[model samples]
Target: MKERTIFQKFIHTLVDILVLLSLAWFIVYSFFSLYRVSGHSMEPALSTGDTVLIDELSYRFIKPKRMDIVLFQRADKSYNMKRIVGLPGETVIIQNGRIYINGELLETTKISPIALPGLAKNPVELGKDEYFLIGDNTDSSEDSRFQNIGNVHFAQIRGRVWFRLLPLRKMKLIV
Candidate 1:
């Protein structure tokens, strides 16, 4: 009887562990996604072939902030990664190879001069649900400056990229 009771306890413990693990797997699978960087547009920040983990839950509770690297779907239903530059209700214009927000020069770190202002040569106004995104490598990026990708709607954003996971040695939190 003693031996049978011990085996039953062990089995119960095993079932509890399995249940906990299953719950954990479900949460991670639903709330996180992996994205692989594909081009030089985000160079000097995220390189091609670098894998990153995206948090799909945070944006549901809070709005995305400027400088946040995000994964959003384009009009053609393709995904692209970029940094948030201009937010809702703001006017953005690129002139003299510099970016101006609300008639003031925008200051940022590590951003290169714009070679082509594209549609932003004229002031581009953002709506309440719109966001202007740009790649870190301005000259090489096809972003809000172009008509096709003019402004990203909040609903089109997939998630915020927060961690770099691949190329083991370079693994770190994406700021």
Candidate 2:
């Protein structure tokens, strides 16, 4: 009788462990995904090969705002990470290595200096569904400033980067 009781307890504990594991799997697969940074575009804030937790569900309830780092599907069928500098229906310009929005100068403290000018040299007006994106490392990123990439459409946005998971020394919530 005692052996049977021990066996039952073991089965009960096994079932509980399985249930907890299943719940964790469902939440991670449904609401979030792991993303790895591929380039230096987001340097200083994020680095190449940094694995991040992408919150894919939040965008469903909220539109992306300025300064938000987003992962987007590029025209070439690749994913690129960049910071949102101009929102929909806004004018963005880059001149003399600086960014201007709606004729107002925006102080850029994150990105590297732009040594070369791109489409932003002229006033680029964003449509209602367009968002201007640029890399924190403007010197190396090919973002909305290029004709091929242009402005990121609302549909192309995949998710917002929320945290870093690898490189324990650098791990933290990405603000």
Candidate 3:
């Protein structure tokens, strides 16, 4: 009888552990995802081969803000990361290698003057759901300035990149 009681307690503990693990997995699967940075576009912030953790749930509760680093799906269905420069209902233009929004200079330390302004050479208007994105590496990034990538719609954005998880030495919050 003593042996049977011990075995039963062991089984109960095992079941509790399994349940806890399943709950943890479900939370992670529903609220987060991982992405790898593949190009120099977002350099100095996110580098090639850097792994990032994406928070998929926050956007549902809050609107994306300017300067947020986001993971979005391109029209080709490939994923890319970029920083938000212009928000909805804004006019964005690139002149003299600098960015202008609503006829005013958009200043941020993250971006430098870009050599190739792409479609933004002319004033580009953003729709209610559209956002202008650029990479930290202005010269190399293929972003909203170009015709191919264009403005990113809210639906195309997968999640906000909040943390860097890989390359243990470099691990830190991406904010």
Tell me how far the alpha carbon of residue 72 in candidate 3 is from the true structure, in angstroms, after superposition. 0.7
Ranking by lDDT: 3, 1, 2
Candidate 3 local lDDT, 9-126, one digit each (tens): 9999999999999998898778999888899999899999999989999999999998999999999999999999999999999999888999999888888679998999999999
Give the Å error, residue 39, model 3: 0.7
Specify the highest-TM-score model's number: 2
TM-score of each: 0.85, 0.86, 0.85
Kindly indicate the candidate among 1 and 3 with the higher lDDT: 3
Span of ten consecutive residues with least summed lDDT in model 3 = 106-115
Give per-residue CA lDDT, model 1, range 1-175, as digits (tens): 9999999999999999999999978886889998999998888889999999998999999999988999999999999999998999999999998888889898987567889999999999999999999888998898999988999999999999989989899999988
- Each model's lDDT: 0.92, 0.90, 0.93
Best by lDDT: 3
With a 3 Å backbone cut-off (N, CA, C), the pairs that clash in candidate 1 are: none
Off by over 4 Å in 2: 1-22
